[model samples]
Target: MGAIYTLGNAAANRLSLLLLTLISAEVLDVDSFGVFSLFLMSVASIASISAFGGAATINSVVSKFYMRSKDLASSVLTMSMLMSVFVSLFLSALFSPAIYDIANASGAYEFVFIYFLLFILSLLMAVFSSLEGAVYALKMAKGLLAFSLLGLLLSVASSYFLGAIYGVYGAIASIFIHRLYIALSAGRLAIGKTGLHVSVGSVKRNKEFALMAFRRLSFPIAAASVLAAPAVTLALYILGKREGVASVAEFSIVYQCFVVAIFPAGAIGQYLIAKSKGVLSEAVNVRVQAAKYLFVYGVVAFLGFWVAAIIASHYFHGKYEISISSFLLMGGAASIYCINCSYSSFWSSLGYAWPIFYSQIFMAGSILLCSLTLGETSLEIGFLLGSVSQIGVNIVLLRLTVHEKVAL
Candidate 1:
């Protein structure tokens, strides 16, 4: 039930996102859409920094601590929220120059203000979503889905209406509105259920879990800042430089489809991570089952997406002009990514967070190398390379989990 609710909600939300993108692309000019796409991608990447994996960290920490003391759980929640807002402000200021440069290059310099708004909004959403993860950790799937879908629905309605009238400004406003709803509503549910409230005393007392979470948090942010986020951003920049902004728009659409395909695996991974408890052998079995499920589902999803890509290419060919072949490659990439996510969830649940960080570094490096050398001609190839690199990294992580003795 948890898996179905989670996956179903994610799919609905992503579909709304896809629709929002399509409407933005249709209403705004290609150049504007390109800028919007970059902003969205930037949000995803920078969110890792602002969020610092706080959601996952809080989820892991709260799940364990709640059993012993709800106050500790609440303290972690407060600390996470505080940390998210602070990091959002800090990182937004830090990245202002880079944001301006990208905006100028995309021929949308004026949109930088909107970009910053969206960036900060992304931070808030990421931080609050960590609470959502906590809710999921407690197996309250339906409640999580309700708030999530409500946010998406509101976002889509506002974004579409505003984009038609205000163009880029309206589009971003829609995003901000959507994220704000999620942040507030989900935060409330998470806090009420987990007994989360601001307590300065509790914050100072719960030092151990905070430190552990911080240690786990450092790796993903480093990986994102250095490798994962930068690599994708660079690839998009390269594609824009070589082919034009329309290329960015095209590939962004393909990536959105990939997002839809991998979401189910991610949903299952979340369920497994939350439910995974007991002895080492039990954890091992959970990992094994996760791998098996992803393998089976990835294959099935690939075929479905491949077919859907063909149909979408035929329908959207005149307006979007996306290559069927490129869309097919994205489907393949999404398939591999599902299994990768499964491994990621399994390891994180077991308290071996370093492997995910290491693997992301490898994946980023591979994408950078491949995009610079081979992807000058085709963005699809760059994405394929990224997928391959991610799979390779997942394999390494899995091997380490199997062979080495970790005291999780």
Candidate 2:
């Protein structure tokens, strides 16, 4: 399982580089690239919204209920599908204007909608796909990684071929197809392995549990999405406004790579959490474990990214405006932010939503300021500042969490 997880992470990072290279070589232009980035960022953040913490919800509840009835998790997933749909539609409508602008930049109006629709769809599928968190919760990282890697290959290949021919639209369609395959394949396979079935009757019996999940998950995940809003806006305002299409693509390349720490840190942390629940039920200790892993994953993933980016950055040619010093600075800072994501997991795992909400809002707001006002020098600096802000929040949260426990 561990090895498989490692493989999946490697695949994910590799796909990022592959996408960057292909975009640089083929359809990516400066203004067009920035628009692509904006869509990608929005899609990612919105994906989280649609997820509504369903993976965690499934992980937490399935363990508790399946002891009584094995089919319990699958039934709840049916309801989760409904909730995800609600969130996805709400967000699409809420941000349609912003989404429209991003698509217009690429001169692909239909694509903008297609990207958002697919983004929401893939995200929705991911939730159903996450019902397999039970598989993960049960320590089947092998299966988890296998399905994910397959999906990644399909996604990368699809985007490359389709994008070359149809431009950004084709690339997005490929992603849609790839994720669609993963979502379906993983969900069906998990059901077979778990021997679970989804029935409306069983879900009806578990109505209270589903509602409870919504209560706990919706706001917190929404808040996390909100916290990221500033960074997206900063990207749009400074890079979209200043750098144009080509610059946008390069920035997207760099930014996405920098954010890769989110996955490996999440992979290790979630695997541990899934295994440790109930058996290791101390909130204080959970916080400590989270903080420690945050640092460990951050350091390792950070270094790996720096080397990869240095190697890949040269391949993109004149697409970027980043200097060596700025790259190093942002790279280091993003490493720390990845660490912060781990601590965030602690709060999220514990279902302590308000603190997570407030903290992220504060962090994102601070990043927006630096990016918009101080952005004239370079986009890398803005990204660096954003990373620093997140790291600062994590450090404070860690100290406060530990100190409060010690006093008790």
Q: Which pairs, if any, clash in model 1?
A: 55-130
Put down candidate 2 lDDT per residue, 98-143, tens digits, no spaces.
Answer: 6566555455666466546745654655464355555665555566
- Candidate 1 residue-wise lDDT, 1-408, digit = tens: 888887876676677667777778778877778877877777766676666666566667667777788777777666766666776666665555554555564545544664567567767666766776777766666886887777767867887799999987688777777767776776677776556666767878986766666676534644554567657877777767777777787778777777778877877776776777424666667877777888888898789777877767775667677766877777777778787876777666766667777767766766666666774325566556666777787776666667764322
RMSD of each: 3.1, 3.6
- lDDT, model 1, position 264: 76
What TM-score against the true fold does each predicted structure earn? 0.89, 0.83
lDDT of each: 0.70, 0.60
Clashes of 2: 10
Query: Highest TM-score: which candidate?
Result: 1
